[model samples]
Target: MEYYSVDASGYSVKPRGVALPRSVGDVADVVRWAAQNRTPVTARGAGTGLAGGALGDGIILDTSRMDRVRYLDGVVSAGPGARLGAVARLLSGYGRILGPNPSVGPYCSVGGMVATNASGSLSLGYGSIIDNLESVTLVDGRGDVVELPSNRHYSDIISGICRRAGPFPDTTKNSCGYRLDAVPSPDMSHRVVAASEGTLGVVVGARLRTHPAPRRRALAVMRYADARSAAADCPRILECGPVSLEVVGPGIMEGYGGSCVLFAEFHDSVPERGGPDHADRVCGDVRRAAGVRPVMIREGIDRWLAGRNAALSRSLGMTGDRAPSIIEDATVPLERLPDLFDVIRELGERTGSTPVYYGHAGSGNIHVRTPADSRVTEWYLCEVMALGGTITGEHGDGMGRTGFVRRQYGEQNHMLFGLLKDAFDPHHILNPGKILPA
Candidate 1:
């Protein structure tokens, strides 16, 4: 087993054992062992999760090697251990693409993405993992290998869960507690496992839905003189109904203070049938409908897809840096996105610190990376909660945000989360201290 003092960014935490499970049987063995000994286990994937969801004091189950993809009629079965990029590469051969892709694509694991219900710049077009999930197989706290969505007993449990769903946060993208909302629908059973944070059970494998590759593509690079201008145009651009419309504030652009930029991507299923002139007409129509002059439009089917992915991979160069330098994920309602600027700016002023902020403006989900100062970790957490947001949005609350869960979810919600944890893991040995109080 391998251990580290800090994760990707450098957050302070003492990771104990790094267990690499070879298969579902190995996962079950580990769970059984942990249950008997009352040992806690933390599941890890690619170590790319920014929330420290993979951080813990017990054994860390590294699921990176369990990657295996089996394609059925229209669905793909992926091992929880598979890296997201590997899966995407395989799916692309069949003209299929994964739904939600974080900028940190190649490095993240499918399980990690599912754990966080991850969304990306293209999330406006392709929803998160929950939207694409088909089913999941996991080992529950009772040492039972439960196949959700296929078990009638689980359906009854799910129905009961729906009746008791009140104490959870009501939002579009959430990774803070049990995904009870997903379990109510038959198709959403897989979603229940999508963002479980490894606390409810150890995910062995899952089935995912795939989509055909886009045919025609267009981009609208809208430049904003200020953040307000960008915010003002977001709703209008949303009305244009592009496959994906992303916003990156000046904080993300090099040396552009107070300025912001929005990247809009549109997908047309048929491009070979239309000439370049028709493409221009399509882009022009979209621009006119959006009521904003595009600074530039890069046409070409593959070119647009490549550009969107390029923007998503901008976070790959931070290896060997201090841990806390990593980004913290938090999201609010789209209407409250502009207000988040004020909250972050004020928090920085109060804490005497600054953070770089950027994200999927369409969904109001953004990632913030604080300066490399360990002294302000506690303060940054306090401000995040005071602003009526959570410590995690797409990224699950790993060790980094574990200490702040109660405050973010409030007392009532926090207790309900605890109850869900107890129901799933009575002995509290499965990834303890991840999504609930330990």
Candidate 2:
């Protein structure tokens, strides 16, 4: 119980007990027991979530024992406890890979990734979990094992919710509240679980779409005077067909010898003879579009991406007194990125906190590291909402952001979310107090 108290988010709340279920039947049994006892059940994965999504004060259902992976046709079906790294290793032998790669790397679980709709730098090209998911199997609050897309009742209920739901943030990725907007129809209702944060059901297994690995890759590191300039040019750089575009703020650029740096990576899936040359040509086009020459260009595979993925950990190691802030995963439209930077600048001016920014710039999602003050966080989130941005992009609205879900989505949408929750978890025992009040 003590071990399940904290996660990468640094927030602690000791659970009453930790339940390790070895199979989907065991999971259903535990959920059933919890519901009958009127105790909350929180489904946990690798416990590497940056938000407080995996933490709860009631029963902590650890799914690590359910690690299983199988491939059929073009989709990979993985158990809730299966680690992303393990799945990737298995898929690599088949020359395929899952699209949404979270920075936590192999340590994060497939279930956690789906729960948060996780996305990495590659999301700029491949899309998020919600986009790649094919189907899902989960145990609802009633202790019933349900396979989505096959459950017509569940699908119709979600489709009704989607029809009545309001518009979501127009961003590349979003993980704020119930992703009702993702369910275009009853057939695609399984997408509603992508970022539901386990309030609706406990994920047992998921079938995800995989992509062919690129034959060649190239990375170009560009330096800019500030994040604003780099962000202002992202829309243009995006035109070069690069697979990923990431930015590092000054706080993390000390070792790179620059104020801000952007990493643009282009991939060649075709095994043509001129793959390297093609990458070079695209790199040159990217440089021309940005109107700046790259500081360094690495052809083929390299470790440059490892550094970018480690930016969050490095920034946290250096935050002496102020821990990593909760107002980190705000994402806006690509065209509104410069305005997002303006908000960060104004936040610094008003609070005297030097915010660190680094994340998927192409998707307009920038992770911020600043002092965690209630008033400052509120003001910053308000500004983000004003700019048509979501409070969280990849990290789900766990305990950390659940209180603000109603504010992010207005009363009508929030009510729709509650209705969806009721339809799935009639007893309200599955991860209570997550997307809605317990």
Candidate 3:
């Protein structure tokens, strides 16, 4: 119970108890028991979530025991508890890979990834979990096992919600509130659960789309005087057609001897037969788009990406007294990224707190680390919204940002989200006090 009280977010809430479910049936049983007792059931994976979505005051359904991976037809079907790293390794054997590889890939679980719509450096090319999800099997609030697409009744309901739901921020990736925009129709209704944060249903299993491994890859590391200049150039760099465009803030750039650095990686699919010349051409295009020469260029991947992948950990390590703010994952329109940096600069001056920024620049998503101040967080979030950005991008609206969901989406969409929650979990037994405010 004590161990179940906290996750990677550093937020803690002691759960009533933890149940290790080995199968979908076991999960259903635990959910049924929770429903009968009128207790909240928060579905948990490896507990690697940074938003504290897995912590609860009621039952904690640990899905780690349900880990299972299978290749069916053409897609990979994985139990919600399956470790992402293990699944990726398995797919590598078949010359395939999962798209949304978060930095916490080695420790995060498949279900957790789906819950947060987890996206990583590769997401610029492969998209997020919502884009790659084929189908989902979950236990709704009523303790009924429901599989999307197969359950037309629920699918129609989701489609109806989609119609009434408000528009989302015009960004590359979003994991805030219910992903109403992603569920365009009944066939794609499963997408709604990609970032629901377990308030809608407890995912038991999921089928994900896989892509063939890139046969050729190139990486270029570019340095800028500040994040704003690097952000200002993201749009042009994106036009050069790179698989991933990542940025490291000055805080994390200390090791690399730069104030701000952008990593642009291009991949060539096996069928394209791209070779050294292709990599050189892409690098040259990226260099021209950047309007400057690169600090380093490599033909292979991972060598330069190692630093970008460790940005979060490095930022955390550097923060001595200042804490990572709840308003970390703000993502604005690509064109407004420079403005976003300007706002951050103003915020730091106004609050007198040093801010660290990093994340998927191609998507206009920037992760900020600053002091824990409610007033500062609210001001920054309001500014982010004013810039047509989401309060959260890849990180879901868990306990940290649940209070701001209505502000992020407005009263109309917040009400619609409530209706959607009712449609799935009428009793509010699934991860109560999460995405929606009580």
Candidate 4:
């Protein structure tokens, strides 16, 4: 057991003991041990989670050594401790890939991504972890290995709970609730675990569905006069068929010095018999129709495949010393994105703050980051919710955004979340104070 009073971001939070569990059996044993000792347990992955989901005062079960990969059919069962990048590289050989793509890249574990319901720029096409999850093996508080979505008894229980659940936001990507929406799908049980934040149960392993790698790919660097131009161009660009379409605002340009940038990428498994001229023509049409211009157009098949780290570093500029303290992943309707950008700029004025903005323009999900400080920190949470948006859109409402959950989720949904947390962790011992307010 180990203890820490400081967070990775340097914020202080005291934990009693940190347990490194070497296997799934170890995870179960730890949970039972904690239950018997009347000690709370919080499961931790690589601690790469921006939210304080991994930070708490209790027994921290570090599952880093539980990493392993076992492929069966089109499904890959990876340990909760496995790094996403390592999994991505492993699947590349088989011409398959997972759906969720956090900007933090492959450093985070699959369990962490699932916990947050994470998605990246490619989420425009790939969707989220909820879409990719085939099944999960989680150790419940009673040390029972329950495979969710299966066992009709559990589904019946979940159905009843959801019927009584609160009204959730009508958005594409959300990680706040019990994911009641996921229950109706063929993979309904998978919903119970997605974005649970290790509160409901500790995920020992997960089975993920994969897709064949896209064949031909093209990367386009489009320049906009302002966020409005980028916003206006989103709908038109979608018509051109893009696997990844991301927008970077003035803050990113401040570092890169390109007028409001959009990184557009298209991937198709078909061979490029006629080159990317067709895609380029579509891009040109989108630019012209939207009154924007593209700076560079790059095309490749499987030839120009750089590793995940190279890709993520390029998107999130390397600051060397510290990662940005504030980052946002707010999503809105595609039609509302242009207005959303205007609102964001308006927020900058109100808060006297400027954020580095970028994200999935195709999916209407954008990321914003402000400098970390005490001044104006308190109001930031309210301001984000007032805009009729989520404090988190893709990365999730972990401890970083949990404080703002009630505001974003509203009273009904927020209360439902509390009840769900109570059902999973009646003793309030597992990852206490995460997802739900204390």
* Candidate 1 Cα outliers beyond 4 Å, as residue runs: 1-5, 167-170, 254-258, 270-282, 289-292, 299-326, 372-390
Instruction: Please rank every candidate by lDDT, starting with the best.
Output: 2, 3, 4, 1
Q: Give the candidate number with the greatest lDDT.
A: 2
Going through the candidates in the order shown, the clash numbers are: 10, 0, 0, 4
Q: Write the per-residue lDDT of candidate 1 for residues 1-47, one digit (tens) a residue.
A: 33444455445467566678898888888888888988888777777
Q: Cα RMSD for candidate 4? A: 3.8
Q: Show pairs that collide, candidate 1.
A: 9-322, 9-323, 9-324, 10-323, 52-398, 52-399, 53-398, 63-81, 103-312, 114-194
lDDT of 4 by residue, 1-438 (tens): 333444333345778888788877888888888877778887877777656677778888888888898766778889989998888888888888877877666788877877878777677677888888888888877666777667565566666666765555555677764676566643476676788888889998899888777655666666677888888887877776667777776644334465687776776543332354656664565566455665545544223223221333443453333433465567776777787787677657755566557777777777665554444444654654555545566666666767767776677767767766666667677877777765
Superior by lDDT: candidate 1 or candidate 4: 4
Task: Predict model 1's lDDT versus the native.
Answer: 0.68
What is candidate 1's CA lDDT for residue 202?
82
Which pairs of residues collide in model 4?
A: 85-106, 149-189, 215-268, 215-269
For model 4, state the Cα shift of residue 278 in Å: 5.5
Off by over 4 Å in 3: 270-276, 323-327
lDDT of 3 by residue, 385-414 (tens): 999999888888888888888898988888
Number of colliding residue pairs in model 4 = 4
Question: Which parts of model 2 are misplaced by more than 4 Å?
Answer: 270-276, 299-301
